[model samples]
Target chain A: MSAERQERIEARIAQLNAEMQKREDYQAIIRLQRAYGFYIDKGYWREASDLFTEDATYEQGVDGVFIGRERIHQVIVKLSGGNPGPGLPFGQLYERFQLQPVITVSDDGQSAFGRWHELAMLGQYGEHAEWGEGVYENRYRKEGGVWKISALHYFPNFVAPYEGGWAVLKPVEGDWRSPELADFPPDAPPTVNYKPFPDQFTVPFHYPHPVTGKAVA
Target chain B: MSEHLLDALEAHLDSIELRIARQASHEAIERLQRSYCYFIDKGLWTAASDLFADDATGEWGQSGVYRGKERIRSYLALRGPEGLGQGELNTHITCQAIITVADDNMSAKARWRSDNMHCTDGTGSWSEGTYENIYVNDGGVWKIASMHYYVTLICDYDKGWIAGDIPMDPPSETLPPDAPPTEVYESLPGAYLPAYHYPNPVTGEQPKKPDLPELPESGEDTLADAVAALSTRVERLEDQRACEKLQRSYGFYVDKAMWNDVSDLFVDDSTLEIGGRGVFLGKKRVLEYMGIGLGPTGPQREQVINHQQFQGIVTVAEDGKTARGRWRAFVIGGSSWAPVNWGDCLYENHYKKVDGVWVMDKLHAPFTMYTLYTDGWHKATTPNTRPESFPPPPDLAPTVVYLTYPNYYCEPFHYPNPVTGKEAPPPNPAAGGVANMADFASEES
Candidate 1:
C-alpha cells in the first residue's frame, strides 16, 4: 500500500477504537448512577458510598458539602435513618427513581459531568407520606479503568407530604438545611442556597442547548 | 489482490469481529442480571444465589458481608423457605440497566435499579434500590462476583415515606456475617447520595456556529432536481422499528380523536375491542367505534384524551409477515369542565406486513384500572366499561368477562418469565379479598 493510504487506515482504526471506548464509558456511567439509586432505595448505605472516590465531595439540598468518602458515607447514613443501620426500619418506604439523565463527557474521556432528576416516594406506614423531587449536577472520574463519583451536588426541589402533594407546600422559612446533618455539620457551607418551589429556582443547566448547540443561558 | 489490500481488509474484519463480541457480552450480562431478579421475585433463594460465583461475596443493606457462595446462599435464605408461603408478596421489578463489559469479555460491571413490592403477614411495603455488581465469565457462563444492594427507601404501603420510613434490620445476630456492617446509614428524611461507579455519559462541547449566507432559498432550479434529490434519501426501516412505529402512530392519532388517521392504520379485516366494549370488526366498523363511541373526529375544546403508550414488548415472527406485541397505555382523559380521570390499559395487539407496509390487524385492550383524579385509586375507582354504558352498540358480545379495581383481577400473561420460561402464577387476594369491599360492606347495603 502507498504510505499515505497506510497512514489513513491506521488513523481510521484509532478513531474506531476511541469511539467504542467512549460508548462503553457512557453506558457504565449511567449504570453507576442507577445502581446508586437502587442502593439508596434499600438503605444499603455503605455499598452505595463505595462508588465514590476517596476524596469525593457530597452535597444535598442545603446540607452543605461533606468531604472524603468516609464522612460522606456517615453523612448519608445519618440523614437516612440516624442510627448505624444497613436497612430502613419496617414500614418506611423510600423509592428514589433516577430518571432523564443528561450527561456530558470531557474530550479526553477521563472525566465527565451528569445532570439527573430524582423522583422520591418517601413515607411511613399509616402516618405520613412525602414526595421528593431533586436535580443532581454530578461529576465523575475514571480510576483504573473503572468510573467513580468524584463530586455529587443535589438540589432538592421539595419534600412535600403526599396528601395534597407539592401543591400544599409553603415556601421555605429561614435555613433549609437538613436536620439529619445538623449535629454533624458539613466540612463547608453549600456552594449556593436557593428556596425550592412556589419560589421558583432553576438548578442551572450544565450543557449547551441540545439542538442549537449554543450555551444554555 | 495486492498484499496491502488484503492487509486493509483483514484489519477491517478484525475490528468488526471485536465489536460484535462486545455487543454479545452486553447481552449476556443484561440477561444474567435480569435472571437474578426473577429468581429473587419468587423467593427462590437457592436459584438466585446460584447465579453468583462460587467465591462471590454478598451484602444487603446493613447486613454486613457474607463471604463465599455457600454463605451467600444462606444469607439470602434468611428470608425463610423458597417459593414464599401463602399471603406473601415478594416482587422485585428490576429494570434500567447500564452495563459495561471488559474489552477481553472476561469480566463485566453493571448498575441496575430494582423496585420492590413486598407484603408479608398481612402488611405490605414498597421499597426500591440500586445494585452495583461485578460479573465474571466462568466457563462460558456469567456469574455474579460481588453483589451490593444499596437501600434507597422501604416505606409502609398505607402510610408512605414521610410518615412511615422503615429502618433496615441490623447485622443478623442469628446468622452472623464474615464482616461487620461495612456501611451504615438511614434512608430518606435522612439523605445520602449513592456514589456512582461510572463517569459522565456525554461530552461537554458545542460545534462552532456555521458561517454561511444569512438566508438561503431552495437551491434546486428545476422540479426534476428536487424530485431526484428526494429519491436519493435513505431510511433505516426494519421489522421491529416498523411495527413499533405503526403502533405508536395509532396512539398519537387516538390522542387527538382523529378518527380518519386512527382508522387508516388498520386494514379492511382489522378488529378492535377495548375493555367490555365488545368487538368492532372491519375498517368501517372500527371507524364507527371511534367516531361514534369515542366522539367526533379531531380534538375538541376543553377536552383531553391522551392515550400515551409505553413499555412495549414487540415480537416479530420468523416469516417476517406477522408480529404480536404487548403494550400498556396510561390514559389521561377528561375536560376542564367535566371531571378529570386517570386510567391504565393493557394491550395485546397483532400486525401484518402487506405490500411492504405494516398494518394493524387486531387491537384488543383491556382496562386494568381507572380512577377519579381528585380521589385517586385507593379511594375511588371506575369499573370496566360495559357494552350498554355508551351510545353505539357493538358487533359482538364482550370477550373475557373480568372485574376491575376494588375487586382484584389478574390479567393473563402474554409471555412467561424470561429466565424461568414458565408463566407466572395467578395473583392471590390481598388481605380480605372481595368480601371486605362487597356490596354489603357499603352504607346502602
Candidate 2:
C-alpha cells in the first residue's frame, strides 16, 4: 500500500476504535442502571448505593436530593426500615419493573443520560398491596473505566392502593423526601409540578425528538 | 518508518476493526429481537414469520413447537386473519433484553420480558411472560432460530393479581394446541419459575460451554487486508445506529400526529399496516392511512396519542443496505368526545437505506389488545375484529379468529424447540387433562 493510503488507514482505525468504545460505554451504563434496579428490589441498599459515584446525587418524588454515595446509602437504608440486607423477610416483598427506557450516550463517551418508566408492586404478604408508577431521568459517568450513577432523579407519577388504582385514590406526596434521612435539603423542588393521572403532564425531554430534531418540552 | 514499526501499526489497525465488528453484531441482534414484537402486534403474520431462518423452530405458551419457516408462517397466520378485526386489541410490550452474542458471530441467545394486555369479546386481562430466544446469522442476515416464551402470569384486568380471585388458567375450551405445555407452569397465584437462558450477568457464574471464538492471528495479515476489514466494520456500526434512530423517529412522529413527517420516513414503495386496517401500499396511500387516524390536518387539540416504543432489538444486514427491527408499543390515546383507551402492540418492521438514509420498507403493527380505560380490560373486553367505521377500509380480512385473555389463545412461534430441534409435539390425549390447580394453590400456602 502507498504511504498516504497507510496513513489514511491508521486514521480510520482510530475513528473505529472511538466508535466502538462509545457503543460499549452505552451498554455498560445501561447494565449499571439495571443492576441498581436488581439490588433495590431486594432491599440491598448498600449494594444499590455503591453503584453510584462518590459525588452522585439521588432524588425521588419530592424528596430533597441526597448528595454523595453515603447520603444515598442512608436514604435507602431508612426506606427499607433500617434493614438494608439482601432478601426481604418471608412475608415482605418489593418488586420493581424498570421498563420503557430511552438512553442517549454523550458523544465523548464519558457520560450518558437515560429516561425510564418504573412500575413497582410492593407490600407484606397479608397486608395491603400497593401499585406505583414513576419516571426516572438519570445520568451516568464513566469513572475509572466503570459506569456509575452520577445523578438519579425519580419523579413519582402515582403510588396508590392496588385495589382503587390511581384513578380513585390520590398518591401520597412529599413522603419520599423524608428530611430526617437526608444529609441536607434538596437543591430545589420537583423539576416539574405535575400531578398524577387523570391530570396529565409530559416529562421534559433531555434529547431532541428522534426525527424532527425538535426539542420535546 | 522502520519495517518493524509498519508491521506493528498494521496489527493495531486489525484489532480495532475486529472490535468494531463485534460491537456492531451485538447492536444488530438486539434490534432484530425487538422488531418481532412490533410485527406480531398488528396481525402481520407474514412479516413476523419472515424474521426467522428457514430451519427455525419456535414454542410459545402452550402452543406446540413449530419447525421450519413454512410451518412458522402457517402457525402465525392462525392468530388472526390478514388484518385485525373490529374492537380487537392485542399488545405485547417486551423489555429487559439480556443478549449474549457468540464469539463466532453466528449464533446468540437473549432473554426478554413481555408485559401484555389483551381485550376481546367483552373481556380483558393482563399477562406477563419471558422469552429465551436464539438467533443465527444465515447468509449475513440475522434471523431467529429458536424462540420460547414462558408466560408467568395471566390475570383479570379488573381483579388484578393481588385480589386472588381470578383463576390462573383460562377455561380449557380452545382446540388442542399443536403440542402440550412444554413445562407445566402456572401464572401468578401459582408458583412457577421459568428457566433462565443464561447465567446471571453479575454474581452468577458463566456457563462452561459455548466458549468465545479465538481471535484472528495477526502474523500473516497484510496492511491492505487490515484496511479493507476496518472499512467494513466501521460501515456496519454506522448502519446499526442509523437504523435504531430511524425506528425510534417513527414512534415520536406518530405520537404527535406528524402525519407528513411520519409518511416521509418511509420509502416511496414502502407499505404500512395498522391493526386490521389492511396494507397501505406506496407513500401516498400510507399517508392517507395516517390521515384516517389523525384527520388530514394532523393531531387535533383534544387528542392525546401517546405511543411509547420500548425494548427495540435491531439487526442490520451484513450488506449494510437493509435492516430489520422489533419493538413494543404501549399506546394511550383519546379525545374530548371519545372515551379514553389504552393498549399495547408489537412491531416487526423492516428498513432499507435509500441514498444513505434509512427509511421504513415495511411497517407491521399487530395489537395484543385495546380497551376502554373506564370499564377496564376485564369488563369491557372488546374484539378488534373490524371497526364499525374505519377509514381506508382494510383490503384484507383477518386470517383467523383468536380472542384475547380470559380466553386462552397462543400466537404462533417463529422457531422450534431450542434443545431438541424437533417440532413441538402434538397435544397429548391427556394434555390439559386436569387443570394444574395445585400450582395455583402453591403460591398462597
TM values, all candidates: 0.42, 0.44
Indicate the DockQ of the complex predicted as candidate 1: 0.01
**Candidate 2 residues A43-136, lDDT tens each?**
4455577788899988876676778888788777666545434334333445455665556788778888887667665554345555566667
Could you tell me the lDDT of residue B14 within candidate 2? 59
Native-vs-model 2 lDDT? Answer: 0.59
lDDT of 2 by residue, B159-201 (tens): 5443422434431234334455567655444434455554322
Per-model lDDT: 0.65, 0.59
lDDT of 1: 0.65
* Model 1, C-alpha of A51: deviation from truth (Å): 0.7
**Candidate 2: stretches off by over 4 Å:** A84-90, A171-188, B1-93, B96-113, B116-155, B160-445
The RMSD of every model to the true structure, in order and in angstroms, is: 23.5, 21.9
Residue-level error in angstroms, candidate 2, position A120: 2.0
